[model samples]
Target: MSSTLQDLVNRAVFYSTEVQTHFGALIADAEWEVDFSSDPHLTFTPADGAVLRTRPHLLGSESDREKTWLWGWENVNDFPDAIVGLSHEVRKFGAAEEVSELTTPELSLDEELALRLTLAAKEATHKWAHYPAAAGAGTTVWLLVDAAEIALPAPQVKVSVRALMQGLTQTTVTDHRAAIESYVAKRGIPTAELPEGGLRMLFADGSADLSFDDQRRISNCDLNAPLEGEAAEQFAAAAESTGTPAEAATASRTSGSASAPAAEETAAPAVPTPSAPAPTPTDEPSRTEPQPVEEPAAEAIPVAEPKPDEPAAEAADASHEQKQPENEQPRADESVQPAEAATPAEEEPAEEAKPKKKGLFSKLFGR
Candidate 1:
C-alpha cells in the first residue's frame, strides 16, 4: 500500500499538473494532501477551485447527518470545515502545520499540487477528478483512494487544445504521451528523444524543441519561437529601432559623404582642365592674324630707304627712264615732289639735246 501510494502520489501530482495546464491554475489558491497513517485520509482546504466547483462530487457525498454548510457540503460542529478535516492532519504534514501555525504563507509547487489533488478527492472509496471538456461538458476521470492505495482509471480524456500540449511536458500521463507521440509520428514529425534531456520534433526542412512549462503553461520553442506575423513583426520592427532610425535625408547624406572623397578625386582633374586651357583658344587665333602682318615686307622696305638719296636720282637719265614705269601708275599727290616729277617735263630737254648731238655727228662724218 505504501509503494502503491507513492506511485499514486506521483500520478496525482501529474494529474493535477495536467488539470492546471488546461484550466489555468485552478489550484492557485487551493491546498490539498494525501496522508497515509493509522486512518489514511485525503485532506485539503479552500475547495472553491473551478475544477472543484465545476465537479461537485469532488467534495465527497454528504453523510446522512447533513448539517448546514457554506455551499452544500458537509460542515463540522463549530466551522463549515472548508479545511476538510485537515486540522488533525497538520502535525503529520509539515506544510499543513505551517498553514495552521501561519509559519509561512507560501507553498511549494509539489505541496500545493498534492494538497489540491487530495482535496479534489471526495469519498474514501472513490475520488474523481476531471480532464478538460472533450465534446460537451468534459471527460471525468475517477481516482479510487482508500486506506490502502490510490487507483487511476484508463479512460479517454477528450482531447482538447490542452491535450495537444500534454505530451510536450514532463508530467503528462503515459496514455497521453502515447497518443500525442503516435499522432505526431504519423504526421512525419520525426521525433527523437535526447539522452541528456528534452524531445526534438523534426519537420521536413526544420525542427523545433517540444518542451512545455507545466508551471507557466508555455512552450520553450528555443530559436523557433514566435518570430513572425503580427506580434513578432511588431517586435522585429522595434528591433530595428535599437540603432536609431535615420531619416531619408540623413541616409542620403551618409552615402553622399562616404562617396564624396572619391568624387572629389575624380572631379579634381576635370575642374582645373577647363580653366588651364582657357587662354589657349584666344592665344592661338590672336597669333595667326599677326603672322600675316609680318609677311608683308612693304612697310619695312620704307625703313631701309634714306630720305637724303632721293635728290640724286633726278640727275641720272636712267632715273628718268625708271620714272616711266613709275608714271604708269600715279604716285600719291603728297608724295609727288619736284625732284620726283621731272620725268613728265623732260620732253623739252630731249628735243634740244637731239639737235646738238646731230650737228656734232655731221661735222665728224663730213656730210
Candidate 2:
C-alpha cells in the first residue's frame, strides 16, 4: 500500500494529539488524572472509569506496508465490543464505531489505502503525536483522534467484506445481534440493505458509508442526520465524543479527506461533454411562468388610412385640412383638384356610423 505521510513511528502505540485533547476534554468536567508515559503504551488513566489507549499497527500486506491511522480504549471492563471489520473482534474499542475492509479483488492496494486515509482523517483515530490541552468542559465530552500530529498508520491486509457481512447476516443470529447491539447497547444506529445488494451502517451524525455490490465491491461511498429524549441525550453524552480543530483537521486529512484520483469513465471524451443542467422542481415551475418580452408599444406604428368613400374618412380628411397650417399646403406633384373644384359639387352623402357601447370599466367609473 502506498501512503502519503509526513513521518514514521516505531511499533509503540499511542493516542493521537487530537484524541488526547478530546480525551482530556472528556474529563474536564470532573476530577481527572492523565498518564503520558508509556506503561503498556501511552494511556489515559481516568480515575473514575474507562482508560483510553492509542495503538498503532502496520496494516498493509507483507509485501507493501503503508501508514495507517488508528486509536483505541485502554481499560474498560464492558464496551459492547465487536469488530465489525473483516476479522478483527473490535475496532471501535472506545465506543460507537465501525470498520470497513475492501478486498484486493474489489479494490486495489492504492484504492483501499486511499479510502482508509480518507476515512481516518474525519472518523478514524490516529496515535498520539500532538500535545494535549483539555478542551472539553461542562456536561458534554469532546474527544479527538489526532492532536500531536501523529503520522498515518500502515495499511493492513484487509479481510473480506463479505466475511464481515456474512458474520453480520441475520442467520448468524447471535453474531448479527451482537454486531449491532454491541454499539446499540450504547445507542440506536442505522443499517440498511443497499439497492445494489450490500450492507451499510449509519449514524444520525453526518458520516460517510460505503455502497458495495453483491460481490462485495464498493460501488460508491456517499458522505451524508436527528436526536431525541432525556435518556437518549444522557446516553449520547456517555457513548463517545470528539471535536478539536487541529485533530479534526488532521483526522480529516488522513482518513475521510484523503485525496485520490477518481475512476475515469472507460470512454471518457478528450473534451468535456456538455451536460444539460437539470431543472429543479423550483426551476421547472419558474420556467413555465410567463415572462413578458419587452417591445415598443403599438402606438409607434403609423395608423392605416381608412377607406376613401366612408363618411368618417371624408370627415377625417376635412378635419385634417382644418388642422394643417395654412402655410403648409399638400405636397405639389401639381395638386389634384377636389370634385367640387373640378365640377361644381355632385357628391353622394354617406350614412353616419352608430356610437360605440361603453365598456364595463367606463360605465362603472363613468369615464
Which number leads on lDDT? Answer: 1
Residue-level lDDT of model 2, residues 1-367, one tens digit each, is 3212111110000112112212223322122121222221223333454544532221111001212212212111111112112112223321233223311111223312321222232223322222111111100001122223233221110111111221121011122223332322222233444455534443333222345433333344443311234323432443344333322322232333224222111110011101111222222110001111122121211112221221110000000011123342222111111111011122345565444322111110101
Q: Which candidate gets the maximum TM-score versus the true structure?
A: 1
User: Candidate 2: misplaced stretches above 4 Å?
Assistant: 1-188, 206-209, 225-367
- The Cα error of candidate 1 at residue 45, in Å, is 23
Model 1: per-residue lDDT, tens digit, 130-183?
211000011111112221111111111121122233222222223333343544
Alpha carbon deviation, residue 126, candidate 1 (Å): 11
lDDT accuracy of residue 29 in candidate 1 = 28
Lowest summed lDDT across 10 adjacent residues in model 1 is found at 265-274
